[model samples]
Target: MRLITCSNSAPAYPAPTDTVLRTGAAGGLVPHLLALLRDGGDWLFPVRGRDEPRWPDRIGPVRLRPVPVDETDRRAHYETISVELLLWLFHYLHDTVAEPAFDARLGRAWAAYRRVNAAVADRVPAAADPDALVLVNDYHLMLVPGMLSGRPRVVYAHQVPWCEPDYFGLLPAAVRREILGSLLACHSVVFHSTRWADAFVRCCERYLPGVTRTGETIEHPGGRTRVVAVPLPVDAAAVRALTTADRTGAWRTELDRMADGRRALVRVDRLDLWKNHLRGFAAYDELLRRRPGLADDVWLLAVVARPRHRTPRHLAYESACRAAVARLNETWRRPKGPDPVTLLDATDPADTRHRAIAALSTADVVLINPTYDGFNLVAKEAALASETSRILLSRTAGAHDYLAPLVTSLDPCDVDATATAMQAALDRPVALPDPPSARRLRTAIGADTSADWLAAVLGTPRTGTAGRDVHPTN
Candidate 1:
C-alpha cells in the first residue's frame, strides 16, 4: 500500500558529532517516528533547517522519502496550543475552572492551530497519492484528516491524554465542535490508553453537536470514527541493553563513582511544569529531616534533559528546582559532608541514552511523580532495567491504571505523603531480585513493538466498554 505519514517534526541528520543550531527540543516522538520511517514510507514534516548537508532536499536513507512542508514557520504560538492548553485541560479534569489567562492564551492557540491546519490542507491534498494511506500522529496533526481531500484513507492517533465531557467542554463551543468533527473525519482514532480513548468518546457524546454513539463508532455531523486503545511499548530489549551495569563511557564512569558507596534514587525527565521536580526535591528533603541516621546513605540522581528554547516560565521553574536542590544540599551536608542530591544534566544533544544508562543502572529507587502524564515509559523502563528498584509513582499518571498495585503510588502535590512513601520504600528495601509481579509486568509492557502498534492502528476493532477503566493483564 502507498503510505503517507504526517508529523510536525522532521528528522535531523548529522546529529551529535557535529551539532547544528536547533531551535527546539528534539521531541520524544522524533526517534520513534524515525524508526517507523526506516520501515519505508513517505513522511511529511516541517523543514528543520537550511544549513544541513541536505536542507531543501531529503535527509534520511533510501526507501524513506522526506517531504518538507516549506509553508511552516517556527512560531511559539504552536507550542501554546500543543502543550499549554492540553495541559490545562488535563489539569482541570474534575474542576470547571481554568487559569485566569486561559482565555487570552486560547486565542493565540487557535490562531496557530488554524495556521497549521491550513498549511497541511494546502500541501497534503496536492501531494498525496489517490490510494495513499495517511497516518496522522498526535494532537499536532489532529485536523489533517479532515483538511485533506477525502480520497486517501486517514488514521488519527492521539498519543496524549484526553479529558471527559465536563472538562473538555472548557473549550469554546465552536472550537470544541471543530476538534470533534475533525477527529471524526478519520476512518479511526487511536489512543495510548483505554482511559484516553473512552474520554474521547464521552467528549464526543456530550460536546459534539448531534452526535450518536452506536457501539465503538461515533457518528457526528461530518462523519463517523472508530475509537481504539493500543498502548505503545518501549523497546524492552533495547532499553535493557542501554541500562546494563557493564556499559562503559566517561559519563557512566563518573556517575558510577558518585554512587560507589551509596544507594542512588534516580529520576529522568525534561524540565517541564508537570514533571513536578520541585516537589520531588521537597519530599527528599523531608525524608532527610525525619531520619537523620539515613543521611548521606542515599544519593538522589535527578537526570534532567534541558530544552533548547528556554521560555521565561521554563527558566523560572528550572531556577527554582536548582535552588531547592542547593538549599537541601546545604542544609544536610553539614561540617563538609557530601551533597545528598546531585542534579545530573543529561542534555548532551548527542548521546542521552548512554548518559541515562549511568543513572538507571545505579538506581536503588526510581522516582517518577509527574502531576499528570498520559503514560510514562520510565516506569516500564526502570522496571526492566533494575527489577529491584522501588518506583514511587504518581496517582494521576495513566500508567497508574495498571502499575498502582506493583509500585508505591503518591499524589505528586502532597509533599508530606510522598515523604512518607519515600520512608516506607527505604524501610522494607528490595529483597527479591525483581518486583512482586515482575513476570506479569514484563509480559504486559513488552508484548508489542511499534510495528504491532501500527498494525493495531490500521485494523484493531473496539473490544471493550467505553470509558471503562480495565487494567491490562499479563
Candidate 2:
C-alpha cells in the first residue's frame, strides 16, 4: 500500500513504503524522528530554510528530497501567520475584550502561509502514487487537504478546534471560508478527542452555509468528510521497559539522593506559556504555604524542556517561572531539605530521558498540569512508566477526558484547590501502589496502541482488539 503523510514534523514511526513530507525547524521531535528515519527506507521530503544544510540524498535505504523555502520571508510569515495568528485562533487564546490587531501586514503573512502550503502541496503528490493514502497533520497544513482536493486524504487536528462561531468569525470572511472549505475537501478529518471533533463540526455548520452534519460525517457542496475522534496512542510497553531498564542507574541514584526520603512532585513539560509553568509554580507555592509541614520535606522536580520558539511571550513566561522557583527556594528551603523546585533542561536527549525515567520511577506525585493541550502524552507516560499512582492532572487537558477517573483531577487555574489536592495526596497512606499494581493500571489506562491509531486513521479494518471506542463526535 502506498502511504503519504504531510506534517510540520516527521512521524516517530515511518514505514518502509511511507513517503513523509515535512517542514524543517530548529527544535522539535523532528530531529529525533530524523535519527530514526536515517536507517529506514522511507522517502523523506523536507521543506528546509534556505540557510540550512541540505540533507544527504540518501541515508542507508532512506531517501531525502529537499525543498528549499526562503527562510527570512517564509519564517516571518510562518511565525506571524501560522504560529502567532492561527495557533492563537485555534487554541482560543484571542483576547476578545482587548481584541486582535489584524492589519495589512498580517494579511501579507496569510498570503505567504498559502504560498508555503502550496510549495508543500506540490511536493506531496510528486512523492506519492495516484491512490496513496494521503494524510495531512495538524493546523499547520490545514490548507493542504483542499490543495490535494480529490485525493484519498485525511487531516488530523492536533489542537483544540475553535468551535465558537464568534471566536471563528474574528478572521476575515474569506479566510474563514477558505479554512473550512479546505478542510472539507478531505475524505476524513480526525481529532485527538471527541470534544475537538464536535467543535470542528459545529464551526463548519456555523461558518459554512452549505455544510450539514449527519452522525460523524460533515457534508458540504464540495464533498462528504468524516469527522472522527481517534485519540493519539502511546507505546505503553516501551515506556514500561524504559522504567525497568538499568541503564539510568546513576541518574536514578541522583534523583533518590535529591528526594532524601521526602515526597517528590515531578512535572515534565516545555517552558511554553500554555504549559502554564508560572501557574504551576504558583500552585506549588500555595501547596507549601497551606501545608507548612510538607514544605520542609516535599520537593518539586520540574524538568522543563527549553522553549523551541523563543517568542516574546515564551521568553517572558520562562523568566517569570525561574523567578518564582528562586523565590520559593529562598523562602521555603531548609538547610538539608530538598529544594522547593529543581529545574532541569531537556536539551540533551539522553539526560532528559534518563531524568524523566528517574523522576517517574521515584516520584510520590506526578503533576501533569497544562492550561490547555491537544493531548498531554506525559500524563500517559507517567501512568505507564512511573511507580507513582498519585497523578494530579489538569481538567483542561485533553487526556483528562479519558484518564480523569484514574487520576486526581484539578483545575489548573485553581491554586488553592490544587494545593489542597496535593496535600491530600501526600497525606494518603499509600502515595503509590506496588510495582505490579502500577503495571496493571498502565495497561488499563493505555487502552490503545499507535498501530491501532494508524489503522483507524487509514480506514483499514482492525485485526486487533486493542483500541478504545472511536465514537461519533455528536
Candidate 3:
C-alpha cells in the first residue's frame, strides 16, 4: 500500500516509506513512525509549499522519497498580479467600501492558496493504481483532500478547526467559512481530542450545515463519514532509554554544577509566546521570591528553542525573557544557593539532548505550561525517563488528558497558581510505580506507535504483526 501525506510544515526529516509524516509539531511521534515504516512499508512525505534546503542526516531504516514542488509552480507571478488587478477592478465597478475594504487582502492570499493547491494537484498521482491513501494533515493543506479525485482521502485534525483565526489572522468570515466547508469533504477525519472534534462539528453546523462531515452526524446519510479519536502516542520506553543512555557525560556535569547540591526545575520548549515560556519563568521567579530559602536550592533550567522570526512581538518576548533571567539571578543568586537559573537555547540536537538528559537526571520538577498545545510529548518523555522528576503540566495540552495521573496539573495562563503548583510538587516526594507495572504500561503504549495509530485510523495495513519486533532503519 502507498500512502501520500501532505502537511503544512515540512517534516523535520524524510520518514520511511511505510509511514508518512506530515505537518504539525515535531515530537516523539516522528521517530516512532519512521521506525515502524523502516521495519516495513512505503512512505511519501510532501511539504505543502517549499522543501527544506537539506534533509536530516538520519532516516532510520525506511526508504523515503522527498516530494518537492517549487513555490512558483502553481501560479506565475504575472498571473497572480493579473488576478489582483481584476479583483480591484471588480470592487471598483461595484463601488465597494473604500477604506480598508473587506476581502481585499484575501485576493492575494487566495491566489497563493490556489497556487499551492494547483501545485499539489499537478504532483498528485493517479489512484487507479489502487491501494493508495491520500492523507492530508492540518490547516496548511485543507485544500489538498478535496483535490484528490479517486484516492481514499483522510485528514488529521491536529487542532480545533476554529483555530483557523490563529493562522489566518485577517481572513474574512466568508473566506474562513468556505475553507472550513472545503476541508470537511475528506473521506475520513481524525482528531486527537474529543473536545477538538466537538468544536469542529459545531463549527461545521454553524457555517456549512448542508456539507458532508466525516462524523457520525446525519451529514453523511449513507454512513460514509468516519471521524474518530486517536490520541497520539509517545514511545515511553525509547525516550526513557535514549535519555538514560546519554553517551556524552558532559551534560550530567553541567546539571551537577547548575544544581549546586540543590534540586532542579526545568521547562523545555520553543521560545514562543504560545508555549508560555514567560509564564513559566514568572512561576519560578515567584517561587524564588516567596521561598528565599528554596531559591538557592532549586535551579530553573529554561531551555528555549532559537528564535525563528524577527517580528516585533517575538523580539520583544525574547528580550523580556533575557531581562527576566538576569534580574532574577541578580536578586537571588547566593554563595550557598543553586546557580542562578540558567536560560539556555537548546535548539540544536546536541543541545536538546543535553538538556533532556540533564533534566531527566537532575530535575526535581518539569514544567510544561503551554497556553495551548496540539500535544506535549516532553511530559510523557520526562515522566518515563526520570523516577524522581515530578511533571507540572498545563491542563490545555492534548497530552494532559492522557498524562493526568502522572502529572501535577496547572492552568497555563495562571502564573500565581502555577507557582503554587510548583511549590506543591517540590514539597511532595516523587511517585514511583512498580517496575513490572511500568514495563506493562510502556508496552501497552508502544503498541500505539505512530505507525499503528495512523494505520488503525486510516484502516491501512501495518507491516509488523502481533509478535513482530520493529526497529529503526539506517
Q: Which candidate is the best by TM-score?
A: 2
RMSD of 1: 4.6
lDDT of 3 at 300: 86
Q: Compared with the true structure, what per-residue lDDT tens digits does model 1 show for residues 192-299?
A: 666777789988888767888886678777776788766655666667666653542566678878775877889988787778999999999889889866666888
The worst-scoring run of ten residues by lDDT in candidate 2 lies at 465-474
TM-score of 3: 0.77
How accurate locally is residue 161 in candidate 3, as Cα lDDT from 0 to 100? 20
Candidate 3 lDDT, tens digit per residue, 1-474?
555555433445444452344423335434544444544433344442455334542344433444455555333322332223222221121123442244555466566665665555556566555666666655545666656644555554443223322333233566656555555566667765554555556656555546465434426322355565556666655565556564525777766776778878888776755678878888888877788888766888887775333345567878998988888888888865545688877645545654665666567889998776656667766766666778888777766655555677788879999999999988885665535644554455555566666665665736423111121111
Query: TM-score of every model?
Result: 0.85, 0.87, 0.77
Evaluate all candidate structures by whole-model CA lDDT and list the values in order: 0.68, 0.68, 0.58
What TM-score, to 2 decimals, does candidate 2 have?
0.87
Candidate 3 or 2, higher TM-score:
2
4-77, model 2: which lDDT tens digit per residue?
55656543333344455232422223432343344443332335565225355444455544555667556755
Instruction: Give the Å error, residue 274, model 2.
Output: 0.9
